[model samples]
Target chain A: MPRPLTIEPNEKTILYTINLKTLFPVRRTLTEIFTRAPRRYVHAVDGISFMIEDGDIFGLAGESGCGKTTTGKTILRLVNPTSGVIGYRPRKQLLDAWRDMGYEPPIIDKFGSIDIAKIPGKYLKPLRREMQMIFQDPYGAFNPRYTVYQILEEPLIIHGIGETREERIDLVAKALEAVKLTPPEEFMHRHPHMLSGGQRQRVGIARALILRPRFIVADEPVSMLDVSIRAEILELMVEVKQRYNLTYLFITHDLAVSRYITNKIAIMYLGRIVEMGDTRRVLDNPLHPYTKALIEAVPDPDPKNRFRIREIPIKGEVPSAIDLPPGCRFHPRCIAFDQHPEIRKYCRTIEPPLIEVEKNHYVSCWLYGTPDEVMKLIKK
Target chain B: MSEVLMRVEGLKTYFYTARGIVKAVDNVSFTLNRGEVLGLAGESGCGKSTTAYSIIRLVPPPGRIVGGRIVFEGQDILKMSSEEYRRKIRWKKISMIFQGAMNALNPVLSIGDQMAEVFMIHKGMSKKEALEESAKLLSMVGIDPKRLRSYPHELSGGMKQRVMIAMALALNPPLVIADEPTTALDVVVQAQVMNVLKKLQKEYKVSIILITHDLSLIAEIADKVAIMYAGKIVEFGTAEHIYLNPQHPYTRGLLASIPRIRGEIKKLEWIPGIPPDLVAPPRGCRFHPRCKYKFEPCDKEEPPMVEVEPGHYVACWLYAKR
Candidate 1:
């Protein structure tokens, strides 16, 4: 007997549990061994992992140079990895086992394999349809010379989704409608320069959704838009996410924004995932020191509430990604470091592994160590 | 508590482009009190930048200040000679921390040379005297004096912003127009940059005209905020009054749009339409098309600024008494 899929009224969408892990280590340089190198070879993304269910919007947030973007692009197979695995359940299989195994693995497919990292320049076209990127700058995304219709139609033509001209036009119209650029006729013939910042970004969203890709990487999609129009775009994306049944890897520097759209959030620091868990848990009650600092940095809108805010003064600048420290990436600036001396020694000597603190909540701090006398060291 | 430092009345800055006459700042009026931080908040093309540019007479070619009176420290800055204005006002009495001014610094020259230029141009100080003052200024902004020798590229983005602040304050300017000071830096870096601005403003007693799109940022630093839309002031009030009780529809929309780190939104509501074109703005209220609470009077006639309470002003037909 076939099981019937039931839709519960007023019930939240049950997303497929997909816990993804992407780990890669950097090659040690002479400067690293001698401790006198001008540049440091810190693993930008060292053994970091998290999950985003089918209906869930996942957020990757960190301070600048924290490799939040790198983690997103790597999961989308935009960058080649030195080590570790990327797990995903897609509707179709475009990537083969060799590609998944990492570094110079053989081409498994007969028609010249499309290894996400090593795929030749020619094959990127088809692959682009499966995974698309929405950049931070709306104006920069489209060709200045191309009309709105042309920009939206390019993806449709490249994918060969429609056979007739009318079919393609219909697709473009639908894409525009999905992004809330209503009437479609008003904006189709206009150029990128003709539209405002908010309108131009809708065009960018339309172009990404024309192909109906299952997954998307929206990198600071509304950061550049006007204050009043930011919600309009976010609302449109949320609507489209349900209509298309899509999954997103949302990367942003703003903690407020990440919490707005995503259900699950991962906090990155110096190219490593410091913590990953439910959005409410991570944002409201952040486990890592870096996450706590980020949440505190957001300025409250209400003026009278300003003094009530527990502001954590972020001292000093982000340590250079090219040269990181020997200990926990956030150790130098972390306010909690002095209080936990027993945890401090190990954090400096060795990198902490991502361990599940509670159900569905994970952290990379040495406070929650293995069972038995880990507390004895703390007492001493 | 203090006298007004600068006053702008009936300001209109227009750019005569090939397409049409783009009215960037249309009939704008405001006053900056001594030791006050007035945040001019708006989206891009809302004429916030043009207002600042017009005040300083930095409006470039094809863009002319058609009608306005700019009174700075009891003198008409608009009517002053260019040479006199350059010598007395710019970088001396009323200076500006230009947006991305850090990028404007010469990459080849040392930070010391940049600071020295401001001192030499404004104060006519000797090279030796300028160097000493520059070192002191750098230390004041929390940077090490040794970094005076480093070029612009050698410093981080935050450091560059600090150096720009140091240079702007070299002449003891009473008022600094910071146009989007922290727009380019990261969140943490932004916090640091804003902290420096706040600290410097307190220590020096210099008034600031901060123009930015981020409401939360303005809320943190601004004593009073003026919301601009389609080249006009739509709402003006203290940051507390505006945030807690926004009277204008446009202002309300802006507050609702921002994603908060603390709150959870099931389905965020957005303002329905885009801002009107500044080149050919709407005949009545520019925001009438998207305003949810708009009345018929809003579409037929423009609303004049009305005081609903002490120190709180709104330009909306909904609030204005007939």
Candidate 2:
């Protein structure tokens, strides 16, 4: 029998990581092949680090190729990271097997934080129950052939939970009801193709929630749905979070939606987190130039502000991640670099480390100065 | 009001699918004036794109414009022959910038070659003259004229969108139809593209039909707004009238649901249900199922489009008797 898992005091961090990176090989051309060109890699996720607290909705925001999706997938172990330590506080059931093996579980420090990145494949199976993922495309995530019942039951079946078919069906019905797909039996026989985008998304949420996971990485869950229905799903997610005490790592490129749902947000640029803090603080008083540009770019839905062309300070396109610029990756298109000549030299020569500007607020820019000599570059 | 560039009346475009007849754009009517941006706003499958396509006479197969009168510059476009329309009115008079239009450019063709093709086919210009004209249009959209030599893949998403804008303006059309021009673009890039579009719109004094699902984007550029639902325009008026004083419940719900960047962050009151299926839309008011302000007549009677105030129109039973 598995040993009972122990809970630690003051362990707020559900998941924390340091300098995670994911790289993929680039395809070479014929001429390059003939010349025996050196291999190149696309730095998809480059040295990003952040902590997700228990029951917190941590938003990862960025444009395409910014690696927000990759970061989420890495946390769920869907995409293996090249390097870095991922500290995860596993649920009780997950650590039971390790305890049963008569091995002292690698619960480091008083907080019981274990480096999930170092865990072997055999141990990852039990841990999978505690960490689940919700994909962006509801249509593509589920099999067309599988009925809604089959789709929801597959996870429980694989995890060897709920011994009888009747027991699993009860759980499925309850999950369906929780997502407000009422009269659950009505949907059980229906296939994914029969469901609308919003309905399918609810099913996706129900599937994710079935395991009652401690942490979930939701990747652009509403980007594919209609705007009218997007809010419904978002509201349902918020309700579920409170009901289950689930920690969410919500990934999206949209700043508006992120602002509405997340308590904390981390803005990514070219695979690096440029700024992070309490959602309101980062959005209301953004210090990073990139963050400022992102906020200014959001089109205000008021005609009074029509034709009021605000000059976006940043110039040029996002630089290619393959041949990343020296020093700060954003230096090429950064407006602050041009405005403040004093910091330009530092920005162009050395990569600025992520440092706390205030309590919980962090930024990685030379304008904020080094940790030892923190400059009051941002106005209060 | 302001020289009408294009006036579409009683337009009906339907898709003959195996399931049923899909009323993609049913009885839609609107007018575009000179130098004005008319935004056709709606959720997905709300027929905003079909309305744009019907105006351009580009509605694809399985879908046909059953009835409509599209009058452009005092000429009935629906009466023109397909060949004549393609040769004369299309691009030369009214061009289109489609969603992900960047991908529409041939990968093998240079930006110069693509833009030059527009002139070659329409104006019967030589390659040299067309290239020169293309370069001019490129610069007009804020892109380097030298990028004419670059391939589509070489340019970023924003640059590619700009190239599409340049191509649309290559013939200097009086009216341009941009369908979700910045849908997939980043916020910063979207701003850049919108800036270029706004500047060029003012410079050229061209009327534009901007179709998008985002209300915020429409509020930024559109002078007039039409809120669509289930293939019908639920409300129509100037941007100020439609936004500041929305009479339609659907419009009200949409505006309320979007989270604002400024002001106090409040809990978004999301509309209850999904948009009606076009294949079998509701009997009367399509949005009644999700509308909180729905009345007894809403589910039984089709609401007529009524002018509540001068130039402000709404199609709802709540304001029907007013």
Among incorrect, acceptable, medium and high, the docking class of model 2 is medium
Q: Residue by residue across B1-322, what tens digits does model 1's lDDT show? A: 6889999998999999998999999999988899898989887889999998888789987999999899999998989889889878887887777898668789999999878887776778998899999999999988999998999988998899888888878888888988888887877777767778888888888899999988888887888899999899999998887898899888888887777877656455567877777788887888898888877898889899999889898999988887
How would you encode candidate 2's per-residue C-alpha lDDT over B1-322 as one tens digit per residue?
5898888999999999998999999999888888899999999889999998998899998999999899999999999999999987989899999998768889999999988998898889999999999999998888899999999999988999999998888888999999999988988999989988888888888888899988998988899999999999999999999889998988988888888887789888777877788998998888899888877898898999999999999999988982
DockQ of predictions, in order shown: 0.58, 0.75
> What lDDT score is found at residue B150 in candidate 2?
99
The parts of candidate 2 lying over 4 Å away from their true place are A1-10, A27-39, A99-105, A370-380
The predictions' CA RMSDs to the true structure, in order, are 6.2, 4.7
The best candidate by TM-score is 2
**Clash pairs, model 1 backbone:** A66-A271
Query: In terms of docking quality, how is candidate 1 classified?
Result: medium
TM-score, cand. 1:
0.89
Model 2: per-residue lDDT, tens digit, A213-328?
88999999999887778888999999999999999999998889999999999999988999998999898889999999999988878896666776887878888889999989
lDDT of candidate 2? 0.87
Which candidate's lDDT is highest? 2
Chain A TM-scores, per candidate, are 0.80, 0.91
